[model samples]
Target: MARLDRGSVSGAACGPDMPAIEVRSLSFAYPGADAAVLEGLDWSVPQGAFELLVGGTGSGKSTLLSLLKPEIAPAGERTGDARVLGENVADMDVRASAERVGYVFQDPENQIVCETVWHEMAFGLENLGVSRDEMRRRVAETSYFFGLEDWLHRDTDTLSGGRKQLLSLAAVLALRPRVLLLDEPTSQLDPVAEKNFLHALFRVNRELGCTVVVATHQPRPMLEYATRAYRIEGGCICKVADIASLGHREELFSGEVSGWGASRRAKNGVFSSASGQLDSLGPRGGAPGAKKGLKSGKSAEFEVQILSQDDSGVPSRVGGGRILQKMHGGSATTLSEGWFRYDRAAGWVLRGLDVTFSAGAVHAIVGGNGCGKSTMLSVLAKTAKLQRGRMVRGAASAALLPQNPKALLVAETVRGELMEWASTCGYDEDAAQERAAQLGLDGLDARHPYDLSGGQRQLLALAKLLLIGPELLLLDEPTKGLDLANRRIIARALCEHAQAGGTVIMATHDLDFAEQVADDIAMMFDGEIACMEPPTDFFADNVFYRA
Candidate 1:
């Protein structure tokens, strides 16, 4: 039956009082581990309800979600029961289980399998043996719903981080599963894209009666859609009467970091932790070089208000703001572009773009999805040269921290992965261990890189790049998967890098991080730098990227 036609499952899953999912006394631990990551956990989600699950970086949010879906559950010693639709998930028929329970992984990379957007959208339908007519109908409806018609034929590999995330969700939702499990579904999305996705997800729960359980570090975006929330803490789940009522201090940050201009003093690598101590979740704050007050709302009277520079190329208008402002001016052509795109027929991802960054300052590039931020970084890092136009660089030693942290992780153990370049980079075990401690990787040295949490892998990849000690660093969404505390860890690392005379440039949708750490906030649009200013002036005057 068609999902829109059927409305809801109406039977076992949609029964008024039936638990769509139930867990009791469940425990899970990786092989040869000291103790269980989760223990004696009891949780349940009712039919037709929208549930939010919030936790820290490695607090087992992904692990629990994977366990709920039997096929992809991690290898580990397990105990107790995890049931779905009144059937023990481990014993249920694989195909039936997959069709009924749809899972959208935390990382978009984990969910997308096909090369093209259209193929990915129909991949699930084909597996379920849907008729060709039905598959085409579902694909058409979902693409239009997602506003993906413009790029339905586009290659999935070329899509931006936020776009890839949208494709992943659209693909799973095409199948119209009875119960949907999502992990940080909007982590990569920009402000507008995030809002649209949340609206669509809400419809899926309300119109389709699909039970939704989302695990996120930042929960502010979906608070309105959430009916009730449960927090994963200390190996068990605790119900929170009000997700929005909890203050930033107590909510375990509950998914992604909040506070638009929230910041901390980065001094001697001693940035204050909002999450109690180093190894846990906390309110990530601003660095000494971070801008404190970030404003929002669009300005109708918007024009380019570029910061002027003196004859020596130092910024002429450094304010007495709360953070340190670097002086290097237009001479810092952090992003110098002419004209470029992936294909001859495709529109330019970079065209007539020029932005400067100080030699020893941290800069952030903010833009909507597919605004050529990643392409610009790729060109600057010399990973991909611009096809048509000039891109000037510092000729200093450089390294790039990719949006996908897994790209850098190759070895089996965390320590092994970080030390993979010890011989060539002159990095010793002692230095590697110290670097790990600095970034809060203290107890995870022996674990495999893939075995670590999404945020952990993000940090691990960054650690690998920092070990090589490049004079110039290019980061593509460094904080995409981090929790509040780990966000602070990354901020401190970048600030320290800049203070050590290394240049830092990052592309991100995180307004908070851009304000907190970047000396200059540059906004990209239609493959060019529409405007550039210091954090304060940038956030104050921008029309599109104010969030």
Candidate 2:
């Protein structure tokens, strides 16, 4: 194990005492890449400074963080010196670096190791040989700091995306590192949770005196709390003297039409269900109360029977009523009396609830994270069956895109990966190549999937699903790691598919995305379908989404 000599750095050169972090001409590439993702980059974080790293997709922000922790570099791509605590990182072993600098990865699943929330929080300390009593004190302190004490005994897997992130942060805090490096920590969190998280992070930096560095596409919240901001583009970083100069910056990020008739900053708002006279609009005019959707043309009995089909497309239950009476003429799939239970949970994630999803619809499932949006999607995708309930008149074919796109990508080369999925979807060789080219993945097929950027990996996942040619597509937080451009591309793709008679159901916290791609929206509140309707009405009068 390599160790740093205390005398190597003279007086006031160690972290907290000196700079918390320092990098000099750091460049890194993956094993097979020709160009370094981070090329001759130099950066430093002064003690107690709260800084933000802003960049577009594939701009090397993540790669730089990886270099700071020395985790994601390919075996041979790292060069130059990186110092954490004024000690050269390359000379320090992985364990020492982890202990010195706390890193929260862009993906929460990548860092989650324990089953229960308490166990996950205790993991880091236990690994470092902290005693049980010490671990308990630290876990309680960190949990209380992040407002996670209520759920301390909850199963970690059952938490919502935002809650899971909080747990991840709590785990890192328990280790008590002097520096915290966060990569888009708010990406998966809902607006409320995201807001709370930012405040907590501020407290940690201000009250605890920890150096903070975060990489994000949306920079508003960061700018609000950040003392310094650096913009990274084309592998270069430049300091922004005035963050306000980014100007009407929120509008640019969210791209949503606000009441001000201007694009709202996409990052700050939340989607909510409304119950006024919204439906009075009749799906055309501006109504203030009651959400609108296709009315049941037939009796409830008939609708339930047709929706209760088994895996082989046969209805397991029969009901008395006119078969086509409930057919509202639009594509709607529903699960009646749906219920799902996990191993460690005392209650079901979904409990005997009736939910409906229509084709060409853009629905936003809004509940505190862990409200069962993912579980509901699983039933819709047929990946997991509900402990109870029957689905009726579902799409002819469906494709599911999981939150962790990385796991779905298994091919050695990007092109080969696309081809593999295409073949699985019953496409011919020539057709797969054509589809790959159409998806803007023509030349890079030969490149390894693992070597692609975060955005590229997500696009690849979509391409794989599209190759299957399903009539209905389910995407879970598809925009989590994407920038505006790639996110728009994805939205366009989903829209085009819907236009061509395909259906889409996306579960996301991106209110901007909900406004852009959804024809209709559904807000799931506490495992119950609180309200479902068009996007216009969904946002209308909803205080949570106002600019």
Candidate 3:
């Protein structure tokens, strides 16, 4: 777990002046694609430095990161020289590359190779034919370093998204790679979990002397520690003169009028309130008048409590379009005294919870990681049955977009995924392409579903669900990996869904998205709904849950 003493790991010269990663004239195009995603790029990273890559969805950030680790690099017509720790990426020895270069996938679950935490940590080492004693030492050291000792024996599936991601980082560090590459590592994490993970990653770069490179749309959290930054634009990588300038480029991710009544600023990517909105959380399980309005804050005035950004007045909806038809306003579904747990031996996830979702509103479940938000969605989706609760649904049709959007993707081609459910969803190929265009996925019909950026893939999955014309829509982390522009697109889509008399219940860690799009916001804490209210009333006077 310790590699801090390396003079240099790049090139033949073991000197501090050497670069850990270097790229020259790198151009790549996926098979059967229209053009190259990356073209004629030249870049370099200092040894043992922390670096960041900034780009929007489908902008080739993922492709650039993939090229760093040649073993799993995507299939394509590639022309370039990419070197990691002094060795050409394309010509790396299989064993040597696996030991020297570490890559963490955007989806934490995508890279996990074992059922249990212990096995996963050892899996990579086992492949390298590491000595038994050395593997045990590394495992124990890393487990303690990442605070994973508590769940060493737990099944990987039992861990929350945050925990799984942390474990992934720990497992990779167990190999003591000279350089680490992470793609949107904190996309699924809650605020608190993200801070913790960043701290750990920082230690790897500072204390352990491992070169770190991360690609992310959300760069605020990593800006403080980044030694350099590169942005991919028009199939080329451009070095940024001042990394701090990225924080001020609000237009990069957040400049569209929200579909809902309010606006969300993606600059800070954290929620905190100077106003005392906690007082409005009346009573116990929920705020007063919780059920009075399906669209909670159509007329109420709420003060903004910003941590860094200015209190710009609320924005207005620009486009007025409807994707769904309005149905009779009534209860979409009701969960009465819901009680559920994944395993009888495991702790209860939903404890005697009761709530009603109206037919024409966007309701968001906001909470910390591992607070049973996703589980509640599963119970509602019927993917996970509640042990002792009644789910009464008035709507005949419904659809679910899971936390991991790739779960529902069953087809090899992007067009095929849309066509797979065209018959069942009451939509044809043209409608499918139209829906895809609405979510910024129009030109990717020929690519495989797995090849898209994390955010693009999310939109594709959501397009499938929306095409179903479901009256009851369930989404988990609906905007997990999206940039602000895509977030705006999705916000409008949810607005259309609600405007059409459909009901949406989504679990998310993005409070900004919730503030701008959600009509009703519910705070889930420790297997219970701690409070529920409109965005104005919910975030106003609130002291925590913000950065």
- lDDT per residue for candidate 1 within 1-547, as digits (tens), equals 2344333433344345768899999999987667788999999998778998887888889999999888889998999999877778888676767667889877787778899999999998998798999999999998987899999999898999899988988898888877899988887778788888899998888877778999887787788899999989888999998677643432222342332122222222222233322121122243322222212221100000111223343432222211122322224545454678888888888887776667667888888889888888888888887787676676356888887888788898988988899888765777677668767899887788877888899999998998777777899988876888788778767865664456888998887777767767888889888877777778677675664
Best by TM-score: 3
Which residue runs does candidate 3 get wrong by more than 4 Å? Answer: 1-13, 248-324
364-431, model 3: which lDDT tens digit per residue? Answer: 88877788888888888888898997999867777899878889898998899888976654556766
**What is the descending lDDT order?**
3, 1, 2
Worst 10 residues of 2 by lDDT: 272-281
TM-score of model 2 vs. true structure: 0.81
Question: How many residue pairs clash per model?
Answer: 15, 19, 10
Number of backbone clashes in candidate 3: 10
TM-score of 1: 0.84
Alpha-carbon RMSD, each predicted model = 9.5, 10.8, 9.8
Off by over 4 Å in 2: 1-17, 245-330, 343-345, 428-443, 545-547
Model 2 over residues 422-518: C-alpha lDDT tens digits?
4344555555565455445665766787666666778888888876767778888888777776675676556545533466788888877776567
What lDDT is obtained when candidate 3 is compared to the true structure?
Answer: 0.76
Question: Against the hidden true structure, what lDDT does model 2 obtain?
Answer: 0.68
Candidate 1: deviation at residue 341, Å?
1.4
